[model samples]
Target chain A: GGIITQTPKFLIGQEGQKLTLKCQQNFNHDTMYWYRQDSGKGLRLIYYSITENDLQKGDLSEGYDASREKKSSFSLTVTSAQKNEMAVFLCASSIRLGGHAETLYFGSGTRLTVL
Target chain B: GDSVTQKEGLVTLTEGLPVMLNCTYQTIYSNAFLFWYVHYLNESPRLLLKSSTDNKRTEHQGFHATLHKSSSSFHLQKSSAQLSDSALYYCALSHTGYQNFYFGKGTSLTVIP
Candidate 1:
């Protein structure tokens, strides 16, 4: 069994400040994803990478940027923090089998609070 | 476009009672996968069950769900509710070979003793 680790369990940033969240996985999966979790909104995909150096935007990718520099790591950056905003960012990795993705394994998540 | 819908935002039930969480979906593709994920406090969300075959039921951790393609529904159910079952539940949908997966708004269930 492998694990997905996300750095910085909690983050506090000032309005308009730029913040980055990091994720690392030991599963050797081919795909990684970044999702934003909001109460009552569930998990909304921000970005996903099918392979190293590949990036795909999702429905809620307007203010976020993602990078997959290595097969085991994926990072997400918030361009500008919104005032009084609070949300949890999750990192996940999955392996594709038979032309479809299998179950996703997620990290504990990074809680962000913008002041 | 693919989408999932979980109607109840919150459900409170007494312990030992039956548990039912509604999930519905929409996708243009005929072959779609539906999943139920449970998120406990301070823990990452994990898959509870998933199904792709129509009219077939999948079970895990005492929870079960049946995928009904005719109705576009995959509802989670359990015979008895426990306090440990209290958590946020999400319904998700994915099509064959599609990298993008759609998730519902989620439902929070609280089983009180």
Candidate 2:
């Protein structure tokens, strides 16, 4: 079994600061995704990439940018941190089967706290 | 637009009791895939159950869910609750050839001994 690794288990940033989160997967999956987890809000998709160098926005992509640098890595950047904004960012990868995505394998997540 | 709904924000039950989590969805596509994911503290959220065929029941890890197209629901259930069952549960939906997924607000279940 492969694993998805996310760097920086915790992050603390100041208002208006830019922060980036990185993810790497060994599953060799074709698609990668970034999701934001908030209390009582579940997980909201921020961005997803079907292939390397491809990016697609999701329902909650206003303040985030994503990059799929390679087949095994996906990254997300917070344009400007908001004060007291605290959330967990998750990275996931999945393979496409029969024209649709299969089960997603996720990272442990990066907890972000904006001060 | 596709969307998923999980009504209960929190559920507290005694061990050995039954487990039931409600999940409903709305989508324009007739062929939809419904999924149940469990998220334990400090761990990644993982797929607990998934179903695409209408009226079919899927089971995994002692958890089961049936996809009822007529009712637009896929509810997760178990015969007995355990302490390890306590976690956050999310219901998700996706359509054919769609890479984007819609997830519910989530329900947190706590099984007390």
Top candidate on DockQ is 2
- Model 1 pairs in collision: none
* Lowest lDDT 10-residue stretch of candidate 1 chain B: B93-102
What's the residue-level lDDT of B5 in candidate 1?
92
- Model 2 pairs whose backbones collide: none
CA lDDT scores, all candidates in order: 0.94, 0.94
Instruction: Give residue B82's error in model 1 in angstroms.
Output: 0.4
Q: Mind giving the per-residue lDDT tens digits that candidate 1 earns over A1-115?
A: 9999998999999999999999999999999999999999999999999999999998899999999999999999999999999999999999997788778889999999999
Interface RMSD of 2: 0.8
Regions of model 1 farther than 4 Å from truth? none
Interface RMSD of each: 0.9, 0.8
Q: List the TM values for chain B, per candidate.
A: 0.98, 0.98
Q: Candidate 1 overall Cα lDDT vs. reference?
A: 0.94
